[model samples]
Target: MKKPIKNLGKKLKPCPFCGRKMVFHKEIRINKYGKQVTYQYYLHEDYDIYHDESCILDEIDMPFTIGAGDANPDTGYIGEYAEDWNRREG
Candidate 1:
């Protein structure tokens, strides 16, 4: 099993568009079958305050997974998700 992504000890990159700090969030919810599903994503808190629903680009959810309902402990996996979004040009 892979190691779980740890929020501690790692530095989150800033949003490229607004120069504001980025945040990482992981939500664990149980599916209908009672399996724990982890939804990992990032958000630009400052950007959401001024933008409308269609204009908001703050939340970026990870689109892929290692396995079916698998909980990965690899910090790098989740970190990359945030990093990629922060590096987006628009």
Candidate 2:
């Protein structure tokens, strides 16, 4: 199986919009059938971003927030998610 996330681990930059620090997160999810599990890793600000409608989610509790989600661990597969976030023009 492919890696779930990839970050060059190059130093992370502060958020340009808020000038605040960023945080990383990991999440595991199972499809509706509850037979498979998937992983996600990403970065986000230190505050609540969005709320999910429980009725629609079925059972998963993935939150929607700022930052990027890397489903693949390859350096570019999504690990670049951080690289892209770090590239903020601020």
Candidate 3:
């Protein structure tokens, strides 16, 4: 069951160093028992988001991170990650 991802039009802040955006994942949907279900999704528009990448590749000091949704919803608060990233800009 491969998880699916969709672009939510959520603008990703440009990297302070490279001014580049990150990557988006892909997903596969299916109907089970006449119910639309998402089998372990990796990305959601308003649910858990997962991302851990450095603004400057290989630069651990300057990095942006988001919550991952695996067995559980580790990060489900929308706009929270962005706030954290922008806050760290200082």
Best TM-score among the predictions, by candidate number: 2
Model 2: per-residue Cα lDDT over 1-90, one tens digit each: 233222422245654544544444455567898866645544334334353422222232343233444434454343555667667676
- Per-residue accuracy of model 3 over 4-24 as CA lDDT, tens digit each: 233311334444565554322
- Measured against the true structure, the TM-scores of the candidates, in listed sequence, are 0.45, 0.46, 0.33
Sort the candidates on lDDT, descending order.
2, 1, 3
Global lDDT scores for all candidate models: 0.43, 0.44, 0.37
Least accurate 10 contiguous residues by lDDT in model 1: 62-71
Candidate 3 clashing pairs?
4-27
Model 1, position 88, has a per-residue lDDT of: 59
Candidate 1 residue lDDT tens string, 1-90: 223333521345554444555444557788999999776544443334335541223334332121212223353444454445446565
Better of 1 and 3 by TM-score: 1
Runs off by more than 4 Å, candidate 3: 1-6, 24-57, 61-64, 68-79, 86-90
Can you rank all candidates by TM-score, best first? Answer: 2, 1, 3
Runs in model 1 deviating more than 4 A are 1-10, 46-78, 86-90
Q: After superposition, how far is residue 88 of candidate 2 from its true place, in Å?
A: 4.2
* Count of clashing residue pairs in every prediction: 4, 5, 1
